[model samples]
Target: MTTLTLRGLRTASRFQRVQPHPLLGLQSQFLVPQTPSFRYASTTSALPTRTPRTFPVNGPSTTLPAPLNVPARGENQSLVPYLYSVGKSYLAFYKTGVWNIYTNFKLSREVQRKIDAQNASTFSAAVVSASLTRSDLQLLVRNWHDIKRVPMFALVLLICGEFTPLVVIAISSIVPWTCRIPKQVESDRRKLEQRRSASFRELTTEPPTEAGVEKLAKTQLMHINKSLGLSFGMWDWVGGLPTGILRRKVSRRVEYLELDDGLIRKAGGIQHMELEEVKMALVERGVDVLSKGEAQLKGHLNAWLLSREKAPVEKLLLTRPSVWPVRMNAPEKV
Candidate 1:
């Protein structure tokens, strides 16, 4: 019986050990269903956070921004002494009648002394003289006839008449009329008629170039001898256009000019042109000769004439072709 009990106990222990191994194998199979074949990896590295620079709550920083490098106003350089001398001379001419009164003022010694004295930073004489000259407002008024061609009231009245005709008539009835000579009135009337009738005839009888000179000469009310002079002897010509109507008439004639110095016999013996024609030809040729790609040739021509420096017509054409037409409409300031 003792032997049987020992064998039974050995068998039970063996069975228990085998049973635990089978259960452990089953547990591992169940756990295998929960496990993943591929592990996930993070794509991005961790980034560090930064603190922004902050200003003090009390006040702004003493150091200026990069752009604020200009000098203070009081630190600027002083004006030149010769400039001050010029100012003194201009002041003397304008004020005190000193320039005219002191005839000896032009002498070198007196002039130099005044100029030197005037140049000082706090020159008392200059300051006093300038202040006094500026303050003396009475000297500013002058005789209108001495310098101005027409009275200020006449110009004002003319403008006023155009703008307010009723006011002009009312004022005219109150003021006494100044009588001008009938001959003078007739002369002015003839001049006005000539200006209004200054139309460009197609010159069926003669070319505009030829007819323009004769017409311009005959149209002049003031008789000027052709043999004695190259230019017309009109005082109005020297003084330039007197009225807007006259100016427009002159501009219209100038626009149609196409003649050269010689005779231009147009088709069917219609007209003949002469010297004014030649001048016109020069002006037209001047457009071709003076112009570049896109620029007005006349301005270039004038600039060349004034400065004697070459301006590029070729490069101008290449750069700006649209400005070429501007030459025709340009104002004749010269």
Candidate 2:
């Protein structure tokens, strides 16, 4: 039994020696050596380094295109003349007020009704007068009540009304020297004038080429159309009386010339047509022919131009069949 046990033990020891312990072999392969002979070097230090890179930024361009137009000084003239205009308008209003009073006294239905009512009440005239006085007192009380309800608002309005005239006078006196045209407005006005002047120069100096004529005509037409759009009537003038009059007389005149340029372009070249032929041509193109003859054409044309210039493009495009490119391209006349 001892011999068999010894043989088994020896056999086990020989098997263990042949296998050489799998875990011990793995640890020997993987475990880091702590010996000084096994020093580590950094992988990053052996690799080449790169310089820091930068990109350039873009900036706004300094050079700008020159302005196309410059407005005349006359176009942006001082407000001093406007002050005089205001004074004239005030006088006109005062006169109109007096006329209104006279008209009311003579023609008002309310006034007539009052007179009839008083006449009908002849027997109780004294009582009626006393009642009227009492009613006026009541009206005053009601108004006082209203004023007291919004005391702050009433005070502001009273102060404004009391001081308005004095303020206006002060402003007008100071405005002439102190107030200049705003830079933006002045710049815009100058640009407009420059454009108009350029157009005028082209019309006068350049030979009657179709392109030149067409360009001028279009420019003028646009101006005239704009002016007509902005046109105001008598009511607008009357409404604006309390403020500086909002008349566009100067602008209208400029636009009128523009309209004339368009008309002239339509009637062949300026050099091609006689004055009479031009008038006839204008009449043909919806301009009202004055019965008073050629002498009155200017005044008539001005009025007619205002009416004609309104929705000029729409009228041309919609009503005039021959003016259309499709019609123009047709073999037969439209």
Candidate 3:
């Protein structure tokens, strides 16, 4: 047995010498130092990265141009479609000029109604005179002559400034006499004038009270705003206008040689006037000084003026009504 064991050990030793030990078999390839396969294993450092690009979104997703209804540029575009584009919107139109016909016509009607209702017995003489160009008046005279006024009645009118002859003749000839002034149009012309003068006294001559002026201002502002496409708490039109006639179209008492440049410049550039300022100017210009709310309006106005230290009004006061007719005390007295 000892001989057999010795022979086996010698055989194993020969086998080990021929090959490597089993424990080193796995690392045998490493001992040979085989080159790394570039195909399977990359040694290059990782790249600094970013997300991949994406395509832009498709149709109608684009933003719309401002003042949407404005005509798109090009030959095919619609003609200056809205007042907004031209900045001729209702508020700008009416608050500025004859636009009141478009904007404040209803309000004027309401105010007139209120006046008529309040002064049912008063005779109102609204003497609105339009200066006629010589050529136009001549044309009108020619037209009148062609209409065949009775010679006697025309003579009477020319001599006495008597409209009665014209009225009577027109009443007789008219298909319906719709345009003729009403005969016996009950009026207290003197009384209304007195009242108007009184109202003015109550407002201007007296110490300030907010009742008259404020009411006038508020009502006028409300109407003007509504006419111009705005209202209380609504100033949306300030930014721009939408499609349509921006203001009610009306014939203006005032004349202008041109629409875009002539009168607009004289009235103060539309761009230069803010909406509130426009309202104030309109009320100040159009309204009669004797309206009922003038006292109240004058009060606030006086306060504002006094606050601003406007000229001619050294100081203002709001004395109680018991002072019989209201009066203003000097600032020193106050």
Candidate 4:
């Protein structure tokens, strides 16, 4: 009985310790359902995700529109609207002036000094520019006359319409830019017509070339001085402005015009500019815009610009003998 029990125990132990299948230990490496397979990947992708840049260079274009000073107009546009605009313009002008004055006065001493200097420089530039151009000079004169009449005009308004009509009657070319009536415009047209009608049938002028610029400039200086029509014949040879004075003036004028030419050309040339601007340019260059057609005016302006464009020699024109007698330094003896 003991032997049989021991044999039975050994048999049971052998059955429990049976050998395992070869695929059981390598199940992960199988491709088939019942076979072993490789392990799944645990690492992320090799390439990185892309993002946009923080800042870019180009943005947008900035071309400007031309300014248009169009007047009020319609089937029933009346004098009231025009009057309102004039009042608005006057108020704006005064408001700007007062504001500028106030701001300038509030600045520190050093800042005020700088501002004053800047203002003086600007004033000088404006004066020189105005005097060099005819239309600008006319405008300057008109404003001056307007300024002189402003006090009387204010008084008339203060009197409660008592002298308003009388003041209006007295108002002619001396009227402010903001207060010009249709009659004034008509008067200007009439003046232009009369001037055109009375002038010479044909006019000619000598233009300076690159070859003989000095002589031409001198001749031009004398001619310009003569054209100025100063009282008592100040530009005539006998009682004329000294040649030195003429030279100085002409030289400065030429330099100013030359400096402005590039800017004007780049700003689409004088030919297509505002009528007043074109007139200003032509008047300064001795071209008659009056009674001329648009094409003719443009042609003259273009010719004027072309004539001066290549002549940087004008800068040294003052160094030459002006349109007057020059005592050649007695041919200094050797």
Candidate 5:
């Protein structure tokens, strides 16, 4: 019986080594299934588990997201909404009279300064001499049309109390205060138009000779120089107040020296002179002309005429070489 038991124990050990235990197989089937072997990789290390990321409460990521697909303020959108917003805000502050008070103070100070400057005498003397004559009154009447529309009540107040100097000053200070920025913008536009018109007229005038063309070129160069030197003045700063916060548009006007076909024809055709002759003339006048294609020769010449060089003229003259080959005399007949 002992020998038989020993043989049975050895057989059982062998059987355990060859096959998985019944309990392990049942657990695997119920809980975890056996994975199939892959031809490339049968075993792989398990990946690390990822933890949830945390961010600071006060960081920009926590802020409200920007409005996507919304058009920019100036991109052909109606301004009714913006105006309504401004009106709403203004109404909130209407009871404060802050704008009116500030305007009145500024105007009073400005008017006083003007009064003092014009008279250069005692305050009483200035007031006494500042009488509105019949012509002055008529001129004011004519100029009334120039002023922008004001409230009917404001107009009545201005007209009824025209005799009273204090009332006149008050009305003048308040009535046009709101329209000042628009008036200034209009004035600046007019000035720019005038300048452009004058330049155009000057350029259109026919120059008699090449020298005249050179003179015009110099004038244009000078104008460019002046424009480069220009900066935003006090008036520009004041006018910018109305729209500066709403938009960052700059009001600078850039003028270019553009010659029309008529003007070009008047100033002698580009092919009137030989390239060598033109180049020589420009060099003599201390103008640097870089040799380019014949197509760009006209532009170079125009630039040469317009350059404002302070250098003294050089005496260099360019001449084309003779194209004819050396002539050989016929061999003497013997």
Candidate 6:
């Protein structure tokens, strides 16, 4: 077993002694200790300050915590360095993903389900316990999605050769999350904005009344489903979405939004939200923020939060309630 001690891993030959990874630094807190003995002292700093962790790797079979997602390469960076840097990052990201899945493969369905349920806790508790931010978990899942697209990337590299970047630029959606250029992100956002623009119009039509269900319930529901990027199962274009499926999908989406709202609030509310986060939240709510400045985005998000956080219950209703207002599936707040 190779044990890596974070505090004093100055040198290692063939990983024979404790050492920092070539790619990962000593300060990387993304990989939490698997052993119960090495628990987080605080979410702000997941690793214990005084004690050193012994990160054991049992060949390639070992599963460590997932790596941090590759952050977007800076805009000023030339294309060559951008490609080179992300290539290394993706290699590390992919290896850890395979190892992670391999370790999980041994679990029984019940155990797996329980683990998953535990993982689905409100961010207030989960951020401290799991040592992973909500975005980290999302990126971790996205990495798995990218794993399946390996063949597609390999094919492009083979056929296009030196022109692979051009091919990738053309088909940017298929590019891995870690490897997406700024152009691709803008392209993807523009596409999502189109759908969100339509859905946002429908979602905000009636202003989430407390008295009863809004008008044109089915049409609004379809738009809600579209905004969430939900799968339209058991419905045809002629019949539109079935009421049963529509209610379930919208409810599930609200539940997820509830979780996200708590996470953002816990992360110190809209004022503390970074520029990228502000953009993302606005876009999700169906605002076109392509040309908006950071200050303007925050103002919009603040307004969104006030309306969303205060009246979550009314927004959750899918049908005319016998009662005046519906109960919200509230997430635990910090």
Clashes of each: 18, 5, 15, 7, 0, 0
Better of 1 and 4 by TM-score: 4
Better of 1 and 3 by TM-score: 3
Regions more than 4 Å wrong, model 2: 1-222, 225-294, 297-334
Model 4 lDDT-worst window of ten: 55-64
Best by the lDDT measure: 6
lDDT of 3 by residue, 163-193 (tens): 3323444333311111122221112222333
Q: Which ten residues in a row have the lowest lDDT in candidate 1?
A: 57-66
Superposed model 3: Cα runs more than 4 Å off:
1-69, 72-103, 119-275, 278-304, 308-334
lDDT of each: 0.23, 0.28, 0.24, 0.36, 0.27, 0.45
Model 2 TM-score, all chains together: 0.16
Judge candidate 1 against the unseen true structure and give its global Cα lDDT, from 0 to 1.
0.23
Candidate 2's residue-wise lDDT over 262-294, tens digit each?
Answer: 433333323333334334334323333333454
Clashing pairs in 6: none
TM-score of 4: 0.36
RMSD of each: 46.4, 45.8, 42.1, 37.1, 39.5, 13.1
How high is the lDDT of residue 58 in model 1?
9
> Mind giving the per-residue lDDT tens digits that candidate 5 earns over 1-334?
0111111111122222433323222111101222211110111232211222111111111011111122235666579865554443333222112222222222222333444466552333332464211112111221232222234324544454322223433333333322222233234334443443444344433322222212333334322222222223333334322333211111111111111111223334344434533443333222233434443544454443332121101101011011111111221111
Q: Looking at candidate 5, what is the lDDT of residue 35?
A: 22
184 in model 5: Cα distance from truth in Å? 7.9
Question: What's the residue-level lDDT of 302 in candidate 5?
Answer: 46
Ranking of models by lDDT: 6, 4, 2, 5, 3, 1
Which regions of candidate 1 are displaced past 4 Å? 1-149, 152-198, 202-334
Per-residue lDDT tens digits for candidate 6, residues 95-160, read: 343333322222112222333366542333454464334343333333344544545765765576
Instruction: For candidate 1, write residues 184-217 as lDDT tens digits.
Output: 3234334433432332121123212222222443
Work out the TM-score per prediction. Answer: 0.15, 0.16, 0.16, 0.36, 0.17, 0.50
